[model samples]
Target: MKKLFFAFMLCTATLSYAAEGTDTTSVMLGKNKVVIHNDSLGISVSIFDSEGHQWKKTREVNFVDGQEVEQVFVFSPFIPLRKNTKRTFYPHFPDFYYGANLLNANSNVVMRDTKSSEWGFSPCQIGLSLNKQNTLGLVSSLQFGFVHNHFNTSSVIKRVEEETCMLPLEEKDVTTSFLKYYYVKLPIMVEWQKRLGRRKIFAGGGLALEYRYKEVSKYRIDKQKHTVSRDLGINALGINAEAYVGFGSVNLYAHYALTPLFKKGINAMPFGVGIGITM
Candidate 1:
């Protein structure tokens, strides 16, 4: 904007010099035509749009040393240079989303099949629009969530020595066994939005840093439940890559864990596909 204003002033000064030589003159600045009319009283400059509509006119009196001189400067009231644009703030985080979680393992690694799922919600979110149109922006938010790893059969997750390992349930009556993680995540993304008819659509992708604060393992043997809470050799800090596209307030997203799901031994990656809604 500053550059544009300077360019306008520079053009005005150059036009003022030219106005002294002619009683009536017209010059084209890009698409707009500037007309200068000089008479005995003073000089008046008029700016006409591409359609030849006159939108602005100005008359001026100049002072040189002790003598008074007349001059005129015309500027467009509605500059074609991104008129009526300003930076603004909005909400960018998804209010709620649920997804199915799965693990991808190396071909050489042997792991049991289990059903995993995750759900999360953003309690606080904010975005800063880079321009007046609000088409491009930066978003940051805090998400609190849980991931549950449920064993398909009678099995439980156990940490032995320094490795988290899966073990089959010794009790024949065991019906369910699962591991759950509670986490807080911080995500930052650059988003682009577009208007389609009356609907607005957006797409964004970014990195999220997550801290898994608590871990719980549980198993139920014929109504008898056993629960344990402890560090299970899992990675405390996790990095995730996420992308989403949506129209209006709803979006579909995919998330992939960039870092390993565990600290050591297990070479597995966790990923998910989900739908989210923004407030």
Candidate 2:
């Protein structure tokens, strides 16, 4: 009986020594065992239930050589907790956007005998814009819009009949004569935008190309209606310089024409200031 009791105590001591042998430990995930071992530099992780699944990641110093080395390892489920760096990602859409602008156009005809400037409100400057993402805080856009301008000239008209033979039969002084010009303009610009709280501010400038397609003139002399339509042999193609500043989805812009309104006789430089909206 004394020999049997001594043998039982020795077996219990052996089992306790085996259970508390080393710092190497294991956890069970279902039927798989994930083993972890702490080293002098870092930790070694292994999966005993899966074949060939083991890796080691060193910290600031190497365990065996005691030299400084970078922490390198493949991404896995056993990564250490680290402070993540912050980053910002902006969303971009490669689609077309429709917008409109209400412009007060100041149009002037450049001629030797006439110094006429017309200021009118053009309400329907509508178009589409395509936007592309460039770099941070920068974006490129291609925009085109249909624009209209009206010019009113108050001048005199001399009437001569066939019987009068080059002599003026009557003189009509016209007031409030209307001249309308229609154009389709294209503007290419790069915008720099910044975010402040919930609002965004943007400022940009670009070149504009305008093509005039139609011109019409109408007036009333002595209570009688008279309309005259003629192709103002003006330069159909015009170039403009533009700049703008705005907040949110609204912007105020200014444009100055670098080319003449008419090809010959009239050297008109057109300019305007307007407000636009983007959706």
Top-lDDT structure, candidate number: 1
1-279: candidate 1 lDDT, tens digit per residue: 354345445554665677455676667777666665666655455556664666532444432443666545465443433232246445446799888776765553333344578899998977788877778888888999888776644556667767766766677877777777888988888888887876678888999998986787787777787884466777989899978888888978888999987776656677878888877
RMSD of 1: 11.3
Cα lDDT, model 1, residue 167: 64
RMSD of candidates 1 onward, in order: 11.3, 19.5
Those runs of model 1 whose alpha carbons end farther than 4 Å from true positions after fitting are: 1-85, 89-91, 106-115, 131-133
Q: Tens digit of lDDT per residue, candidate 2, span 202-275?
A: 77677878777665545556677565544456568888886777777676777788886655443456666656
lDDT of candidates 1 onward, in order = 0.71, 0.46
Residue pairs with clashing backbones, model 2: 234-262, 234-263, 235-262, 235-263
Residue 204, model 2, lDDT:
69
TM per candidate? 0.63, 0.45
